[model samples]
Structure formats: structure tokens, C-alpha cells
Target: MADPSNELLASALSGEGQPSVVQLHGEESPQRCAELRWLYPAIKWWKALRLRGEEDLNGIDAYAASVDALLLDAWSPKQLGGTGHRLDPAWLERLEMRICRDLPWWLAGGISAEWVPTLVHQVSPFGLDASSRLEHSPGVKDLRRVEALVQAVRVNSGNRG
Candidate 1:
């Protein structure tokens, strides 16, 4: 969960290339999304929640109502992020698209350059997180890998659109 404080968020938002979305995780409540939206109407909010099983589906509506987008990360009881394992695509298969038709959603976990096209064709998520796959090691990104992944996403996105 990357819950940066408002001051921190303001600092980053002031920098070059203001991000279109900022994701909140863990103890960061959806109220923060409302606060941020009030403060900076230009950016959108994405709240990352861990998905375990069917029972967790109960709160999907409330969650979706609070943010512009949802980021479903694989549930790992022992960890916070980057489990290096993809959530079963079948998990998404059960969802009714009409439920969240207005809200965009994203997927996370072990996504790779090669998986982008297939995934885009399948779920057509609003976006994806490719950090773990683009890294040479934890916290250290490989520039070449990042570039290749970006190229792959662009090509695949064009194909999907």
C-alpha cells in the first residue's frame, strides 16, 4: 500500500508531467480520494484493494463508488505488494461488466510485455502495473526492460483499440 500524505502528493503533483491518477492502498480510506479530488480536480483516484475470494465481492460496489478506478492486486496474506503471481483470470470471468461499466479498473501482479496483448483482449483493463517484470531486481528498474514494456503496451493498446 503506497499511501502518501497530502503534502507528499502535493509535492509530486507540482512536478513535471503530473500523473493522471494516484493510487491509494492499505489503510488509506476512500475519503482521501474525495479530499484529493476536491484539491486537485485534474487527476483521478485509483484505490488498490487485495482480492481473496468470492466473499470479498460484497464490497465491490461501495469501493467502486468511492474512486474513479479500482486496482485489483493478488491477495497475499504475508505481503503488501508485488507477489510475483498473477491473479487467476477466471476471477475476473465471474464479474458482470455492467456493474462497473462507468468506472475503469486496472490489474496488477506478475504482468509482462508478452502478456499485455492477451490480457487486453481478455479483460481490457484500464491499465496495468508492470513494475516487477520491468525490474532487474526489487526497487531497481532496468531501463531497457522498461522501454520494451512501454513499446509493447503502446502496440498492444493500439491493437486493442
Candidate 2:
């Protein structure tokens, strides 16, 4: 979930939480992300995913200083998230060198086994966010597909560990 309320995030962090990456999405500003981080210092904030075109990158880059990772997702006209659409690879390629260097960024938006390995090589994202492609329906992920994709990326990367 992206841009969750501060109360909800705080409650989740109150438990035995580990250092996890949280991707801020939706209409959240970098200032808001900073506020949430201040409210809960236990959680490590990752990149924020903006829906707008290249324009959103400015806000994202501004906030990137405080985050541990960056993620680029597709924008849609109908819904706020889970649009099952892929972002412009070229756009990511251009920004890959400038914004997220040395940061662990993940590529979201309908990634699959067939495309994940190639995109991983092209964009060189730290990982792939597989959601719609491995889902039997909306919000229901297919484990088999997910496992296959994990295997594929690992094999392609020659990462046996």
C-alpha cells in the first residue's frame, strides 16, 4: 500500500519491525515522506513512486536523498495503482544514470519472467516488482508464476546464492 496514513504506519512499526524498504506512492510529496520517516525512525524509507510523467521525477529526486531505494512504476488514467502497465523503459534508462546511482531501485509495472531478465539487464534495476503478471486476478498473486520468475531472474543473473 502506498501513502498509507501516518497512524497506520506508526502502528505497524510499533511491533517487532526490521529494517524494511517502504515505497511511497500515490499523491504523496517528499515532504510527507520525510514527515512519516520522522514519525517512525525504525522503518527505512525507500523510493517514492510518482504517477505523473517525467515531471514527477523532480519530486522523487528531491526525496531520493533520504530514501534507501528508488522505484519507477507506470501511470494510469483510471486507478491510483496496480494498473498492470509497464513504465517507459527509455525514461527509466535515462534517469538510471542520473538519479538512482548507487541506490537499490526496483522496476515495477506488470513485470514477468519472459521480460524480467531482459529488463533487468537493460535497466539494471536491483530487482523487479512482480504483481499483476503473477496474479490470478486483481490482488491475488499466483505463487507458481512468482516462483518461476524468481528462478528465471536468478538464472539469468547467474546468481546461485
Judged by TM-score, which candidate is best? Answer: 2
RMSD of 1: 3.8
Report every candidate's CA lDDT. Answer: 0.75, 0.71
Q: Give stretches of model 1 more than 4 Å off.
A: 1-21, 27-43, 96-98, 158-161
**Candidate 2 lowest-lDDT run of ten:** 50-59
The top-ranked prediction according to lDDT is: 1
Give the Å error, residue 60, model 1: 1.3
Candidate 1 lDDT by residue in tens digits, 1-161: 27788788889999799998777777566576667778888888888877787555555767566688888788887887787677776566555343477888788988888777777666677778767777888989889887887887898785643
Residue 129, candidate 1: Cα error in Å is: 1.4
